[model samples]
Target: MRRSIAVCTLALVTAVGCGKTEPTTPAAPASGSTSAAKPMHPAAATAMQFLQASAAGDLSKATGLLTPVAVEQLNKQGMTIAPLNVESPKFIMTRFLVTEENEAAVEFAMQFQIEGEQQEFHGCCVMKNIGADWRLAGVIIDPGNGMEPVVQNYEQELSPPTTNPANTVANPAGGQVPQTAQSPDVPQQR
Candidate 1:
């Protein structure tokens, strides 16, 4: 009983730890700024808004600007993909540079917990102008963590890759149980 209690406590702590929120600089001003408020560009503003929504797991707001195909794909995988994130991102404004194009690109960094795993997602996203709002076109999820191709951060090193784990069941006792979606409770990792 004590073992089980310890495990459950650990699991909950891990989950809560990963879900902690971080701050991010959405944009930077080009010239002498009066206030701390960043100047807004319709295109860049649209792009940043979409990213913020996505990062917060508020997919509905983000998808309001998505192309049809993207929406459809997400819906089809809705069971497995929770559009909500486990945590918020902390972005460095100095690195938040925007490109000049109908296609908008912003490079930034963020770290958070999702499903008990703490991860830092840093990359660039390309946006296409869809009427007034910006739509996601392409994303580069890998910037590489100065180590190997797959080795980006320590948190990743600690977790196992999401390949098919041989049949492992969850114990009501859950220390480092490493619960993947394949658990009997979670119905759609496949």
Candidate 2:
């Protein structure tokens, strides 16, 4: 009887621990001073939410929590996808390399499977305190690979530079031009 009780108890605990949803409380309205000045232990909950969202391919909900720029960039790619047949995630965040930063960012590292392939995805999420609300700001994906974000050379994958046209070219010293139509066309230079 005691063994049966123990088995039941263990099963209950496992069920509760595995499929948990974080309570989403709408953050207070944006009042410059009253915002929660910090995010705590978000690595675990946040990671879980991400996995749930990804597994379900809930793009609309997931994108809402992400930076507009990232969404645009991905959509530009042919990867408008929500992979299926993925199993529920087993939260391994407690084993992740997590670091708490200021009120805006938290760093996390974890190993997980995607498409049955295992890879470690670690990144810094830049959160913004907007109107007493703590919404995700942006995420810089870091694989801990020490390599910069991979820039795919595919034409369909490229987005035209968002950089200001005038800012991209370097000006010569003394602000003199080599007679190229570049920057020299500006009457201000004449």
Candidate 3:
């Protein structure tokens, strides 16, 4: 079941979105507020509900919050009905990484005890905003490997100023640009 969860998580990260959606930048959290002063966004709350239901061994409730695709992913990973064996789970934080009109990405951190040892899982989930409802489209969690899940970097991927090496101009400074072909804009040395 643990392996299935991890595998499903990996799959969901890359499989979240199917339609092109404009990204909405979340407001910066107020200084000194660990979880921010604002109420959780609906999409993020949906993800939290899913995690809570899973932790509490309520598979039906958890699945109810997931999109059809997410449920299919769980079924494919052999997690259709199995609930996570987590105890004393507590959400540490939740932040919206990408919030669009029809989709939102939520980054979350939670601590729980499993097999009598405390463990922390931190990752992101993408939620689809349906009419008057939010459903989890995908989820990706870090399984204690000490590396953050890549979903946390979605903002950078969607941000402007996307750089392509071929289009890059040589630095005016002494630093050499790493490229096989010189930029067309730069004068070729004789």
Q: How close to the true structure is residue 49 of candidate 1, measured as C-alpha lDDT?
A: 63
lDDT of candidate 3 over 1-190, digit per residue (tens): 3332343344444554333323333433221123553466677667777777777788899788877666666666555535667666776434564434577666666777767888777666767877899887656676657564443222112223434534445442236655557788889999
All models, RMSD in angstroms: 16.5, 17.3, 13.4
Off by over 4 Å in 3: 1-38, 71-81, 146-190
Query: Where in model 2 is the C-alpha error above 4 Å?
Result: 1-52, 66-103, 114-117, 150-190
| Candidate 2 minimal-lDDT segment of 10 residues | 93-102
Q: Sort the candidates on TM-score, descending order.
A: 3, 1, 2
Q: What is the per-residue lDDT of model 1 for residues 1-190, given as tens digits with 9 covering 90 to 100?
A: 2222233223323322222222334554322123476565454455556566666677677777555555666566452123434445543222322333344444444556668887654554444556666665434344344532221111111333653445345432333565554667756753
Ten contiguous residues with the weakest lDDT in model 1: 148-157
Candidate lDDT scores, in order, read 0.45, 0.40, 0.59
Each candidate structure's TM-score, on Cα atoms with residue i matched to residue i, is 0.45, 0.38, 0.53
lDDT of 2 by residue, 1-190 (tens): 2222233223323322222323333322211133463343444334335434555678666555544444565677755424323444332321222112222333334355788887654443344333443334333344445555422211124455653545333754455654565665567643
